[model samples]
Target: MKTMESIENEEAAPRAEHQTETPLESLASIASVLAVGLFVMTFVFQNFEIPSASMVKTLLIGDHVLVDRISLAPPAKWAPFTFYRDIHRGDVIVFLKPGEPDLFLVKRAIGIPGDHIHLRNGVVYLNGVAQKEPYAAMPTSDGDPQHEYNPYRDDFPSIPPDPMYQVTASWQYELPQHIENGDLVVPPGKIFAMGDNRPDSLDGRYWGFVPRENIVGRPMFVYWSFETPADQIEKQSISERLAFMGHILVHIVDQTRWKRTFHLIR
Candidate 1:
């Protein structure tokens, strides 16, 4: 006859064996997790970083943001609940660079398709009304009267097209076609975007309208922020990039902007 403890152990052993997942079940579980992850990445969200000071004061350089891909999805007649909402004025968005499709950029939507957009001394006038932008970052003082004045930056539509100030050869010719009266009339399928740091940003004013298809998503929040040099992330060699990564690891604690972590991006 077996002891009571031995008898209990024998019974528990078979139960444990029965509870073990089969290989097929294990594979299915892994597949389910992967599928969910893929779906989220493809349709729900994506990671983005503030690579430049174009959106300064609103979003700082080194701020890592999560773009909500779901919000920018194309509308579907059958799936009203799942379709993307319309892009609105003052909405900050991440999009593919109009001139360079490979590059991504972030800017505030100042005008939607069909809206009249213009600027007077860097103050944006949308639909003939001056839209108040509390998020915009302005310079403390106007510097240097002799610094080659860019009429396109200060006063929009008032200045004729200049090859030197235009973003691209095509834009130089196409910009005039969109001007109606004194405002730039956004085409039927494009939106006008601009950076909050108006004086420093190279944006739609230089390039052209942002195509609806070029828009990726709206930034939801800053997941992480590390105070870094403005030009540290610009195009660099592989060795330089590796050096930067190592530097980040060493000084993460010192450089991390703790207050900005999990900060909701407007």
Candidate 2:
């Protein structure tokens, strides 16, 4: 028996007041989100920026990649849920440089532990078999003369390490011990890595073996890429770095390599 106007008025009346979150509660919620993000970045994933063209055509300079820190990590009793696996040949890896422990480097694992490795005119022979490496680049006539075929660089340990080739002092002494029948044997708990831009890269050939413990993780994909100069990393001064940062902001829209965004890394 209620009139339409009276029913409408009753329906429009406020039902209940909702409680607003207190400032302290809001802060706690934010803290929880930050904690989760920190844990994920620290233990599960890590961000790395490509500073050199060592892995060019695969990973270019200024390519910001996300590395999966858990997969290649040693298995842990407490973190049984994590999927851990051993490093394998042809896997692109990020690791601390053997001699320069503080420097991080990215390269392709050409030879794993217990593998015999050697190079003949830029061809990688592993375990007495020549590998079909399509990613590797050999020097061309148009390329820099310095990257041209050399005895120590192309022929590897067979020609022996020469002082002019920038071979590490320790590696020069240790190189002979590992060579057997002209092939350099990768000892246990070590990896032989090389760059895709073979001629330009100063990798395992110039240094030495990468320790298993030095392995950080494998890059999953490139999150972002910019057309950065090869020498940008050399600018260590604060003013130079700040100037480049400003330049990036101004040219970001035009210089960003949009096509390479989210590209998968091999």
Candidate 3:
């Protein structure tokens, strides 16, 4: 028969064992959690910030958005549960800039593959039909005699583009090849993207078409919006971004766009 002291020791032994876990075991648990988080962030969703005024009233600078990466992900043979929806016209998308692959850009998808796109008097026409753009910001040119109308902004795809609206050299070379009956024909595997604030944007009309593979995802909502200038938001380095986040934390009340926070992106 065990003595009282022995029984007490037995109970204490289990308590001690339960409390003591090896450092390696603890590390493995942490690593597992981190791995899952990283996988979700890389393939399921990601955070993006608006760095320019090109999307203006629709998406303002300093707006932090959550993008659903899975919706546009390439189909995987091994992942049967994964689903994909076609990218339709009028969908706002975030994609890698054609000229600068590292830079991510957000714009409305104006033309899909094989679409005949054009613009006239600052209005977009897709497939020979005028698109209803209720979200476009105030027009920069209100027929002011002092403000010279930019041909490229008011009218697009003139055989010999106006020198005033000189496009990128690469786009200049490719623009003519896609012209069909005066409209810019989007080639297969490419999409034409433009900003809601057309007058201030340097989009497909300036750079070139957005390749299929370059598209990242569609923004689900504005998780947070801060009143910050375009120049400050353009800083992309890790240290710079961290510093900017810290600034937001300190000046949250004053800089936060409270009305826009948690706003759904259309």
Against the reference, the lDDT scores of all candidates come to: 0.84, 0.90, 0.85
Off by over 4 Å in 1: 1-10, 22-28, 76-83, 139-149
What TM-score would each prediction reach against the true structure? 0.89, 0.92, 0.87
Residue-by-residue lDDT tens digits, candidate 1, 1-266: 99999999999999999999999999999999999998898778899878888888899999999989877868767667875688998899989988688999999998898899888876778888887888886443457442234577768767876767646777788899999989999988898998988777888888888999998899999999988787787758999888889989999999999999899988
The per-candidate count of clashes, in order, stands at 0, 0, 0
Better-scoring candidate (TM-score), 2 or 3: 2
Q: For candidate 1, which ten residues in a row score worst on lDDT?
A: 139-148
Angstrom error of the Cα, residue 131, model 1: value is 2.1
Model 3 residue 217 lDDT score: 90
For candidate 2, report its TM-score: 0.92
lDDT of 3 by residue, 1-266 (tens): 99999999999999999999899999999999999999999988999978888997899988999999877766778887887876889889989999797899999998999899888877888888987899875345566542345676668876454345667788877788999898999999998999988878888888889998898899999999888866885577999989987998899999888999889988
Candidate maximizing TM-score: 2
Q: In model 2, where do residues sit more than 4 Å from their true spots?
A: 1-18
What does the lDDT read for residue 137 in candidate 2? Answer: 89
